[model samples]
Target: MSKRALISVSDKTGIVEFAGELVKLGWEIISTGGTKATLDTAEIPNVSVDDVTGFPEMMDGRVKTLHPLVHGALLGRRDLATHMEAMREHDIQPIDLVIVNLYPFKETLLAGGSYEEMIEKIDIGGPSMLRSAAKNHAFVTVLTDPTDYAQVLSELTENGETLFETRQQLAAKVFRLTASYDALIADYLGKEIHVTDPERTTLTYDVNQRLRYGENEHQAAVFYQTALPTSYSIAQSKQLNGKALSFNNIRDADAAIKIARDFTDAPTVVALKHMNPCGIGTAETIEQAWDYAFEADPVSIFGGIIVLNREVDAATAEKMHKIFLEIIIAPSYSDEALEILTMKKKNLRLLQLDFSQAEVSKKEMEYTGVLGGLLVQNQDVIVETPAEWTVATKTQPTATQFEALKFAWKAVKFVKSNGILVSNEHQTLGVGPGQTNRVGSVKLALEAAFDKPSALTENAVLASDAFFPFADNIDEIAKSGVKAIVQPGGSVRDQEVIDACDKYGIAMVFTGVRHFRH
Candidate 1:
């Protein structure tokens, strides 16, 4: 006549103590193979599934809880005479409370698991049992997640019966946990490496925060995720020691992180202001990269966010401390490095890095705000190559200038369309980025270029994300006196642009690849 409880969990985080509490509360515990073994080791008495259902587990413990006895107990309403009669006729004891957490399917896929391991990790009976209990909430109480263990126990001790509101909240948690879990399985099966279903996006991420406000401070904002595992996305970031990142902070941090990755081997540094690079440099050492990047435009770098592809050492931190930088992102920091950085400014946000794997196992769906609803697309391209290009002008660029032009081209891809990047040998001099017209952008790019008259020869090379729509780009760019250019030449007047480049004695290469990151 005592109340019975079912407990099974893949993440046995707080199980022993939880079982012990149930023992003190006089609840008869029913469990599967591993859960029962764990409870017995903790000296917690439990009834195994075989003993309770009188049926042995089959299919490597998969068929244990799918039996009629388990569902009958969870679904039966003690207040209903017909349910009680059926329970008595079937000799099934009703289960009062169910605590079940599914297998770590999310973690399994994240840890480079094989197909066999993933198939085994997909939970079956656990979610079914939890959902059954949740639906019959008027008669039964269900719990998922070890985080809820202490709170549930406290409520039971505070009052014998759990509050209706608490039951409702726990039911909601059950659904959300299952939904996120299901989303992971679906997205993994259908997405990731390549889309098995292009128009088959079934996952919808729920917001973790309804932001204080959105871009321009007038629109409403919320953030969500597809629950992908181990991707270097904002969803998995743990802000251990800083103020809440504003909408702008997260956006800029993402941009800076990708930019830093462009120069993988070199100690690259990118200083971002308003989601665009204010200064960028690559050097032999992170310390040197930080120094050159800051020197690229010391005035513009003030209050900008700096990202590094390499680790930040004490020397680099020491140099960064002298400025009013808002944030510093890097792969990692040594103890000495953290000590030095913390001393300069206690609140300067220092973010750890995410070294990219070849293919991320997770893919985020697209969503854009419109007048009536949301417009959606996948995240923009991050990979681009300049392998197939043509030399379109008379005087070709030197190999050194070619390399710099390629670097400049890659940097331009992350900027808005019609972006113009001004770079010398080692660093960006000025960036006239995210403009409406290509000519206007080129002019703005040359604004900070007058500083180094020595590098502004008629031989300096230029790179555009895409081709010049008209020969005017070639004419204006020639005025800056840069004589070489690299672009994806597919415009209608491409030959005219080529003629203009030749007339100005400029060398141009068509990469045959276009990267527009709007």
Candidate 2:
């Protein structure tokens, strides 16, 4: 009997050439619909599914290649006499190779296809054939990815058949592909029905990059990204220069981008280290923003990730080049800026991201994985204005103090829990995050802010991620000469905290919304 190969594909990349190569090797080709027409146009000898199954393709090509003759050929055990006898009785010719790829459901969903169009794009017969062939890998070869075509053909040409190990690998790939395909369809349909928390949930990601190691050198890690990447995401960023991003670099870059996204109204700069915002600044120009952010924490900014809302200019790049930064992310870079940044710092990763669709990007869900399960939540993208806050102190904040409080509130949201930030109108003076106690964070922030005297520090305002449980936090804030304070104001001792601010002549605002990053 002549060796037979089945081929059907939605992505027709290199399919004709692959089929042609198989034909040159004396293998009979079986195909369906467009694949069959494509083979015929290429003068490649092929048999259609209609001829083999004795059933006409129907249901708008949804019912093709699903009959027993096709599946039995793929699933029958060639080594078993019983299976062989049954195949002979049914006039079933065993299929030696199965090549298939599912319909473009993911592509359609990402393209914003209609509900009916998405439903139509889901493949039924294709996955069935793939699973059948994959199950009998002991006697059948399966190929779902086109990249495997060349290797399978080379093996067949040299050895007259694929190695058992090769067949097993291909079989595994088929199951993985089919599983991902099904998960994508299920996720899309689940959202259509407004099912936020289904009893069973499936998630999928494609490997974006394989890192040399994880946070530590001994651990291994890989970066996986969603099928539909968001515009403001670091995974979707285009690397223009420098070495491949490490696991830590990616994490810090993600934090930096999120913080920068919170301040889109002005030219903003965020300096992040170890997934914590060390300094953030918003100003009229990218250059000024860089200067303020750099001045905020010159020491911690070393080896940190820098994210900018506006394009990087030559002046900003020159100032940034003075530090031993790990990464720099920005919307774009002037030609001169790129040249300056990439000139000597070959290991510094430079990522260019588009923030035009940033508001849309905020709609994506955030995920956190634990040992045995995962946690899902909406991203913390809410922005509250100072006008919405209530004056919690007898002394209301001045316009400059209100603006400074607003900036501090925005910056503090990105900090770790027990967070405290001190800033003027345009730049952060100090940030104390992840402290064990609220007062500890307040002390750390105050100490840093008063470490040096500057005009900005004289009119500094403070913001907290959550309410201060005790008045000691207010006492600590008083030592820093911070003129205004902003906090969630939900603590039971809220009155005591307010009285302390009044005693110190500090203006305080209650936002009524907590922003605990942890």
Return the top candidate by lDDT: 2
Worst 10 residues of 1 by lDDT: 357-366
Task: Supply candidate 1's per-residue lDDT for 508.
Answer: 87
Error of 2 at 116 (Å): 1.8
> Candidates' lDDT values, in order?
0.77, 0.90
Distance from true position, residue 89, model 2, in Å? 1.7
lDDT for model 2 comes to 0.90
Candidate 1, lDDT over the whole model: 0.77
Distance (Å) between predicted and true CA of 3, model 2? 1.8
User: What TM-score does each of the candidates earn?
Assistant: 0.86, 0.97
**Residues 417-512 of candidate 2: C-alpha lDDT, one tens digit per residue:** 889999999999888999998888888888888885677697799999999899988887787678799999998999999999999999999999
User: How many pairs collide in each candidate, listed in order?
Assistant: 0, 0
Residue-level lDDT tens digits of model 1 in 1-518: 77788988766888899889878887899988788889989889898978888999898878889988999999988889999999999999989789888888877887889888988999999899988889888877788878888888887778765777777888888888888888778776764566644564446466655677777688777766555533565555555344566677778877777676566768889998987788888889888888768876788899898888777888888888888888887767888888887773767777775656413522444456689766666555445655556787777878777877777777777667777776755677667777899988888777666555554332345667777899988888888777668788899999999899889888888888876767
